[model samples]
Target chain A: MRRPISLALAGLLLSASGAAAGPERVAFPAGYQDGFVRYLDVDRPDRKIKRLFYVNPAALETAKAGDPLPDGTVLIMEDHPVELDGEAPRRDAEGRFIATPEVTNVFVMEKQPGWGEAYPADTRNGDWDYAWFDAAGTLKHSDPERYAGCFNCHQSRAGRDFTFTFFKYVEDLKR
Target chain B: MGRCLALAILFSGLASAGQAAEITVGMAAADYTPATVEARVGDRLVFLNDDSVDHNVFVPTAGHAVDLGKQVPGARSELPLGKAGAFEVECVIHPDMHLQVRVVR
Candidate 1:
């Protein structure tokens, strides 16, 4: 009887590649839009899109540059279609695109120690897991190949502890 | 007999014209060394990440866009040239790093 229950528990943790700790480890960070500290706002005039990057204030207060962010670090990327005039993107006084209120998608990259086991060795990010949630905070499109991009793109920045904007946030933290 | 000899020469020329070589480009110092590569149609571009940091290749040339996602140190990936044209290879993370490859049939 004990053996049967243990077998079922083991199956729950196993992934297709025999790895544990997949995207299930990440839950949608409800209310992150307002509660998290906005760190970066990237505008893509080419696509008429704007991305608002946010990090949980806890990480902004504690993380350092050139070092892996703390295990509990949670970073959120919110994408919006920029406000447009006819065919051109309308810009604010600073020349930054004016972001529309309706969010297109929300992507979250969260790190926790030992989460590295979720991916194969070649593409595994140190300890980060990524998830896609709709604007309503419902998780969607959680395929490994799509999520693999998070590891692949971030892996190139291994020097910055596998982050692009986080180091900038760290820079702001120092000042 | 004369026509047969001409056909044989034509076949030989076609066979020798496109051998499809494999060219390796190394990435280091956040740049692709030998930044310009010349390749023939059907050839392959082998990208080797020689840098200590991570790098990626994205060729955004119209009709030939491809993203060779994350390459860690010592990593290698191959991009096959299916058409003949000049395409610019760039790193998604290090936007400034560029490799120009001119392909011909």
Candidate 2:
């Protein structure tokens, strides 16, 4: 009789664990890419410098008032490496890379309730969860530790929903 | 055909060499100039102190810790990013001074 009760308890625990398991991996929201609109272009002299940013409709709605993004807001940035032809990088009149850069990587930030609770005060970026995805939209789990750096940098923008791009998005909305 | 193939190989080698060249970031008053840098495996990061006060670049992350000591005004230090990863660098004395470095292969 004791063995039977123990077996029942184990079964219950297994089911509970399965239910509590959140997304161990998340796929790139491919549909959101097209539905979203590009709001900013950034050029950096550093690695993977040139890129464009896009936002889902929900994020823009909140940008109108310079308010924090609500839960479920998704933002994506596509990084384009400077184009190279053979051994030389193509550069233009102003010394900027000339070719149409192929999409090399995608960075994503999604605001979901209870998402950033796991991070401590020093690294938390509100409710945002960041994922570095490849051009094919496959998630790169190798650098799980680097996510903290993401939050730390964004913390400076805590006033703007922990996002540096919000002010530019708001400027575009005003026009 | 043999000569053309040899040339192709030589050029490819040079291209790879160029890809892994060093990049620089400057430390200025109150902030890291540019504040963010993109680098690659085997590339070296040269940090130049352009401010009046001293600054340091240190990473507390495990397995990737690097402390560049204190850099007085006009001083410089070079660090090679031997691996492909992203690490954050901050001045120990002034927590507000920070730089984000992303290394790719």
Candidate 3:
């Protein structure tokens, strides 16, 4: 028997065609996430980070050795919202969200050799470039002035390769 | 003693019967990797995120409708299949992502 197509289903099908699905606009480093190592999982109540972070292999190794991240190092921060499956948060005993979550956004930080030279000394984040992709893989444009926030946040961790995850990676290196 | 043992055996059987089988559906690069799947009522659906981005798996049907909060890459979410029917699953954030699941008795 043919299942009747309802108005909602019809609407969804129409909307699907116009949805965003390509990362080409921003030149996002596609397929770079494969083989990347997850070094941390953080639950942020204040930010969009519902829970994990992955770092490229060479970048992770560089950070562990207490060296500066070379050009082309990329870090991916995964974003999710808090959700519940029953009484508790929908997560495994280890606190990793176990259910398919609505991925709200993805943030990327990449370093390029000498790229920081173009920025004024006051605004530079070493050679790092930050880009954000919304759930649909569409690039989210941010004001250039606001870009200061990215470098400023990382500046606090200058001793640790300008990244907050450095100390965590140090611990992992020992293990 | 015989009656108590019989009750225990019946409860054990009931528990075993209630156990649900699990199937995994992965969310990857803007879509569900395996867009179609067949399952039975009382089975479980595990939504796995294989994309670098975040994703939410949702179906609109009453009992089958679920809001998989937000899945980071490598994370998983589960839905308990309670009804027998066809469910069209989509990621609300990425309308381009779609999946279809058929559940049987």
Best by DockQ: 1
- Pairs that collide in candidate 1 are A156-B54
lDDT string, candidate 3, A6-91, tens digits? 21122222122242211221245555546787666654422323545677787666553556665567778767776665555564
- Listed in order, each prediction's TM-score against the native is 0.59, 0.53, 0.47
Kindly report which residue stretches of model 1 are placed more than 4 angstroms away from their true locations once superposed: A1-20, B1-91, B95-105
**Which of the numbered candidates is closest to the native, going by highest lDDT?**
1
What CAPRI class is candidate 3? Answer: incorrect
Best by TM-score: 1
lDDT tens digits by residue: candidate 2, B1-105: 334434533443354544765555666665875577776667677777777888867654322444566788888776767667776676755767778778777
Q: Kindly list the per-residue Cα lDDT of model 1 for residues A38-84, writing each as its tens digit.
A: 77776554467877888888888788755668878999888899888
Taking the candidates in order, what DockQ does each have?
Answer: 0.05, 0.04, 0.02
lDDT of 2 by residue, A73-161 (tens): 88887777766666544544433343255787788887777665544456557867677888787776534454545655667667767
The TM-score of predicted model 1 comes to 0.59
Native A-B interface contacts kept, per candidate: 0.07, 0.00, 0.00
Better of 1 and 3 by DockQ: 1
lDDT over C-alpha atoms for residue A53 of model 1 = 82
Q: How are the candidates ranked when ordered by DockQ, highest leading?
A: 1, 2, 3
